[model samples]
Target: MKKRFDIYKEHYKALISLGLPIVIGQIGVIVLGFADTLMIGHHSTAELGAASFVNNVFTLAIIFSTGFSYGLTPIVGAMYGTKLYTFAGQALRNSLVANTLVALLLTVCMGILYWNIENLGQPEELLPLIKPYYLVLLASLVFVMLFNGFKQFTDGITDTKTAMWILLNGNVMNIIGNYILIYGKFGFPELGLLGAGISTLFSRVAMVVVFVIIFLRSIRFRRYKVGFFRLGLSRTVFGRLNGLGWPVAFQMGMETASFSLSAIMIGWLGTIALASHQVMLAISQLTFMMYYGMGAAVAVRVSNFSGQHDTLNVRRSAFAGFHLMVALGVVLSSIVFLLRDYLGGWFTESPEVATTVTSLIFPFLVYQFGDGLQIAFANALRGISDVKLMMLIAFIAYFVISLPTGYFCGFIMDWGVQGVWMAFPFGLTSAGLMLFARFNYMTKNR
Candidate 1:
């Protein structure tokens, strides 16, 4: 055990370096969301609640596409590590194609969903605000996909700072946009919730455009520039990417779907429950994104080692990330537990909502470790491009297990919002253990 710990020591530093920037970037995104929720919540609770519902529906599409683009990182990482720069470029092109296809697919689905959201038994008053908001958000999905593809490409090549900067700029833009649009400042139409949606859509579009400009103008990206527009879809490359990408996408999609679908269950509890659910969701994203930051670093390091055919280093990198994440989880959970009382009041003025959010704190803390574990090993699997197995495992853990558990607890067991959250621990722990085992098995075989 001591020797193993020592082996991982060096890798831990690498993971930290890679992860810290991502964590920071993730915080920027959270800040953007916080600004929106805070600014909008103050105007009227109804608009705030409407944003929660519409965003919940959009979460599935956002998470799914993000997962889908995640397929690119490992391939790009391996190719870059092996000094196959052109191949890396080609793989990135393939990723773009795959991401674009998934984006279009999601666009069609969201279009359909926009048409049906009114029938979801939502409060009649909120639907008027939700309808236009959902449409504007739908328009941003393609830009999100485009940004994610660039992000995955850069992350795979161990250049996360670009994404960090891009996200920070976008967050700032989003906040400003929200302030102006939500407030109807500078003679602009006071479109209320619709303005917030428009601002978000604008910011998302800007993020993708900036990424494209940076990739084209940056000297570093120019070195490997395969004619971005000239790269036609290659059947072999697409098949290979899909083989690795789809499973990972589904795995992540299932996990997100669990929480997202639970939002609906919370809706059935009442408006207060749904509102509280949104607050918890926002808080939970902070931890999830932080862990993903570290996990992504682990993925890059693992891919680096894999390119050299060093199984030992690959395993070491994964565990190194896991150890770091455990520490982070402990610290974060402690903070959340301690701040449960004040935390809710800090976000909104409603005592009822605050109290409900406080009730869900323990459940949130319980799953942080499992969340960190799964993210580490799952990214480890991605580093080695052994994603198909992980995807299947995620399906069982996230979909077959987690969602049903939450639904049963929330409805059949009458646990309300609290019951819905308990399912997270069971599903996340199961996923972490299974992915850990799979990572071990793969490296041991190698």
Candidate 2:
């Protein structure tokens, strides 16, 4: 029993060591989102609602691009584990190219959405706010992707602190910019929603630039930089990246689509519903990003272990990460539940929006276990490069089960926005179970 306890303790420490920096970085991002929502909500509930709709639309593309960039992590992690520094650097270079392509594709897709924005059943009064905000966000996608490539590369090398510091610093700049531009507090034009968008764009651009400078000048990355400049892109590298990237991208895209599409459905209900959804989503991101931060550690550890052919450690790391995420879910859900009433008011003055946010908290709590489970196991699978199956599972879970259930509950059964939220637990839990089973089977057989 003592030995078992020691093993579990070691696992916990390892996961936390890797995950803490990532969690801190993710918290910074969540804080930025909160600041954006709160500022916009206070300015105008209509602008808040518009931000919700526009953000939800772009979130799908952003998540997809992020997933695509994640293809680099496991590859780089494995190479780093094998002490193949040059190979890892080459992979990172290829990832940059691939991510840039993905950014362009996402931009085109967003452009299409922008052209058809008026027909999405959103409030007409908010179009002016949504249009400029969407455009600025769309323009920032390439920079976001660039930052992701650098971040994943560093994370794979187990140097997570660099990205963490950069993200936190960028977030501080973003919040300060939001204050100055959103309200014209510092001789800046009161740009309102557009100001928030501009702040985000500036922050993203700065992050990428800083990352590049660090990669070039920092001695920590000197070895990787040496190889990075010497290597040329290879077709094999591109193909491998695409093979892993596309499946993960589509899986995440489908999952995000479930929420994004639901946002559209909520928009059909009214501005109040959309505004409430925005506030709730901003809160929920706190939980999701925490889980994802730990999940990313699991991927990094599992990939490293897999490269060393240490199946036991790979499985142990994945489960350990899940355990941490479960704990996080408990704490986050408790806080959100206990403060549901006050939490909503932090973002908006509307009693109706507050009440709606309060109503959505139950569904948010219901899906926490499922969300943590799926995130952990999904990263586990990614570590082993078992991505093709994830695409099918995501489609079944999000598209076949979740979306239909939400539509049925929200529209057909007249349960409204809360009902749509209810469908998340079913879909997320199903996906989690499927992914867990797959990971178990893979690890056991190996």
Candidate 3:
């Protein structure tokens, strides 16, 4: 027991060392989103609702692009473990190409969505706010993708602090920009939702620019920089990236679509419901980002272990990350639950929206376990490069089961937004269980 305990302790320490920076970075992102929602919410509930709709749509694309970039992490992580620095750098170059292509494709898709935004059944008044925000976010997509490529490369090398600092700085800039532009403070024109979008775009571009400069000049990256400049992109590398990337992208995209599409359903309820949904979602990101940060650490560790053919350590690392997430979930859910009444008011003054947000807390609590489970094991699978199955699993969990259940409860049973929220527990739990089972089975057999 003592020996086992020591092993677990070691794994926990390792995970925390890698995960803390990432968590801080992700928290910075959540803060930025929270700032956007709050500033826009107070500007006008209508603008808040429009932000929700447009942000959800853009989030799906962003997540897809991020997933595409993730393919680089496991590849580079494994290579770095073997001290194949040049090979890893070459992979990063290929990742940049693949990620850029995905960004362009997503841009086109977002444009199509923007063109048909009116048909989505949102309140007609919200369209004006949505269009400009959507376009700004669409323009920022390429920069986000570029930053993801650099982020994954850094994360794969187990130097997460670089991205962490950069993200936090960018987030701070975004909030400052939001304050100035949202309220016309500091000699800035009040642009409302458009201001929030513009701030986001500027921050994203700045992050990418900073990452590029660091990669080119930083002594820490000197070795990788040599390989980066020397290694040219090749068809084989591109194909490999695409092969690994697309499945992960589709899986993540489908998972997000579950929520984004549900935004449309919530819109059907009215602007107040949509605003409430946005507030709840912003709060929920507090939990999700923490889990994802730890999960990302798991991917880095597990991939490194896999490269060394240390299956036992890989399993241990993944579980260690999950343990952290479970604890985090408990803490976050308890806080959110205790403050549920006051939470909604932080974003908007609408009593109706606050009440709706309070009503959704239970569903949020119910999904925390599932969310932690799926995130941990999904990263484990990514580390092992077993991404193909994720697409099918996501499809079944999010689309076949969750969406239909949400529709049944929200529409047919007339349970409204709270009923729609109920679908999350089902879908996330199902995906989590399946992913955990799959990871166990694969590791055992190996």
Structural similarity to truth (TM-score) of each candidate: 0.96, 0.99, 0.99
- lDDT of prediction 2: 0.93
Residue by residue across 222-274, what tens digits does model 2's lDDT show?
Answer: 77876688887978888988998899899889999999999999999999999
- Residue pairs with colliding backbones in model 1 are none
1 or 2, which is superior by lDDT? Answer: 2
Put down candidate 1 lDDT per residue, 158-235, tens digits, no spaces: 998999998998999989988988988998988888989999999889998998888888999875676344556678
Per-residue lDDT tens digits for candidate 3, residues 29-50, read 9998898888998999999999
> Which runs in model 2 stand beyond 4 Å of their true positions?
1-3
lDDT of 1 at 192: 83
How well does candidate 3 score on lDDT at residue 356? 90
Look at candidate 3 and tell me the lDDT of residue 374: 95
Clashes of each: 0, 0, 0
Superposed by TM-score, candidate 3 places the C-alpha of residue 150 at a distance from the truth, in angstroms, of 0.3
- Per-model lDDT: 0.86, 0.93, 0.92
Which candidate should be chosen as best, given lDDT against the real structure? 2
